[model samples]
Target: MTHIYNDPRGFKEDMIEGFVRAHRDRVRRVPNASAVMSSRAPVKGKVALIIGGGSGHYPAFCGLVGEGLADAAVIGDIFTSPSAEQVYRCTKAVEGGAGVVYSFGNYSGDVMHFGLAEMRCESEGIDVRTVLVTDDVASAPPEQREDRRGIAGDLYVFKVAGASAHRGDPLDEVERLARKANDHTRTVGVAFGGCTLPGKSEPLFRVDPGRMEFGLGIHGEPGVSTSELLPAPELARLLVGKLLEEAPPDADGTVALMLNGLGSTKYEELFVLYRYVSELVERAGLRIHHPLVGEYVTSLDMAGCSLTFLWLDEELRELHDAPARTPAMIWEVKR
Candidate 1:
């Protein structure tokens, strides 16, 4: 797309080098591998969580690998799954005696590759488990929840897993808690425009100018349907309504609301969306225990946003508030 790139084949390496250069103090390239593990590794007997997927979704796999998110992240090319060898290497590199847990979105290629990596780790005597984040309601019917695709809900999984590890939770318990977070989270997104692949001249999908696609996937996969662009409040209401319908908050429940910027969406716009979402959620008789607003997860340069809600309990609240220092996520210890 009139962008800078020698060839499509070199895109991954180009991006990786740039990323390492930019985050040298916090992230380091995994030795003899195509992944980047956090510099703050070997977390003192804590369970290590490894996550990976195709590239182009910056801040999704690698950007989140820091003090409070993933311990290791393996990346493949744009919209492609990392090889089993890469996954195995990352898992081995980050594994502590407590073991390694792989958390990824539910995609056929990811499942196969990561599954193979898991088996390879088991053969090598590394205790490994996996939790797939499948919270996209637009992918399947309510009765077929397992078939749902994973979207922004992965942020919640990383938060729980990292907090568990930070608290010295054993491998098994970390896996359990991560699974719990995955089960209680849901995400739905919309796109005002599709994204362009590196070196490509045009976007993957086209939305009529001034229109938006509701329930859109990060990769420009078809959304539920198209509609005219509505005002920020109305749009928030419609999107949040879908999430509530799928996973309604408890009468007195507390939750963490994540307002994710797809890619090019401005912070001011996201805050506007959050303002309305918080109001609607509170009006529904539910408490928003914490609110995470920013570009925690993103597609390429797509212009849109996604909403993720995590129904929280006491334990989750503590975990959510725990101190975490990372390139993207930093918190001060609360006395």
Candidate 2:
């Protein structure tokens, strides 16, 4: 059960309040809106990269705002999409005249709301584009990849989009790179338990003892299927197998990888899993490029983890290695 809150309805607001306070050096709250912008936003002549979704996924919408990442992030209530007005306000605050690119998970609400804001911005003569992240392999078949939900793959799409924008790439190129990143990425997750909302006494869903839910959603949704819990190494094989089955057609054997914990999973446990995960990827004739193992996107207190693969080309590799300093992630230039 979730604990420590004044009012359940105000959870998102309270969280944002504390977040901006803690990261004041890197981000600032957008006035009169549920959004945050980088301290150096509105960089003239540079495309503005904006990403957003529900508030529960930290370090995603807000934590990603800083140098070399998203210029702004519009946040919404827990597990809900931000309103179009809030998105529009955020766009006005950081457009910078170069154009704006909005990237977010392919959830229906986010697509509709962000699309509205995109239209409004373009109507006012501000160039704006939208790139949806659809990388969850379990949500759709390979023939219908565009219909898959976006899970941990948000990181790859956002990273490429932000790097492209930060390097002063033209708006068209930024949008293209973002789309390419999404196209090359795929993910699958497993849930060991469910998360409870603030002030709730019961979890959104429950997994039976000794069993696990595979392909869990980040918004308290149940997994696509369930099975007996396997040992860490076996679990690692299951995840890697699912991804490799749908590896992108142009996969060049080099991939950017992430083993993301979904809230309650311990970092130590993820490391144990990654040990076998790394080995299996190499055994499959793939080179892991700067693989990450930690929580990048998460459901509040959910016991689960997802693995993501971003098949990289030369350009994507360079962008993935670019320097970025954000509240949640810090990547430095390779010497």
- Over 1-335, each residue of candidate 2 has an lDDT whose tens digit, in order, gives 57888989999889889999999999999999999999998899999999999988776879999888899999999889999999999999999999999999999999999999999999999999999999999888888987889989999999999999999899999999999999999999999999998988999999999999999999999999999999999999999999999887788899999999999998999999999999999999999888888989988899999999999999999899999999888977453
Task: Tell me how many residue pairs clash in candidate 1.
Answer: 2
* Candidate 2 ranges beyond 4 A from true positions: 333-335
Clashing pairs in 2: none
Question: Candidate 1, which segments miss by more than 4 Å at Cα?
Answer: 248-252, 332-335
Candidate 1 has its poorest 10 consecutive residues by lDDT at 326-335
Top model number, lDDT? 2
> What is the TM-score (0 to 1) of candidate 1?
0.94
Best by TM-score: 2
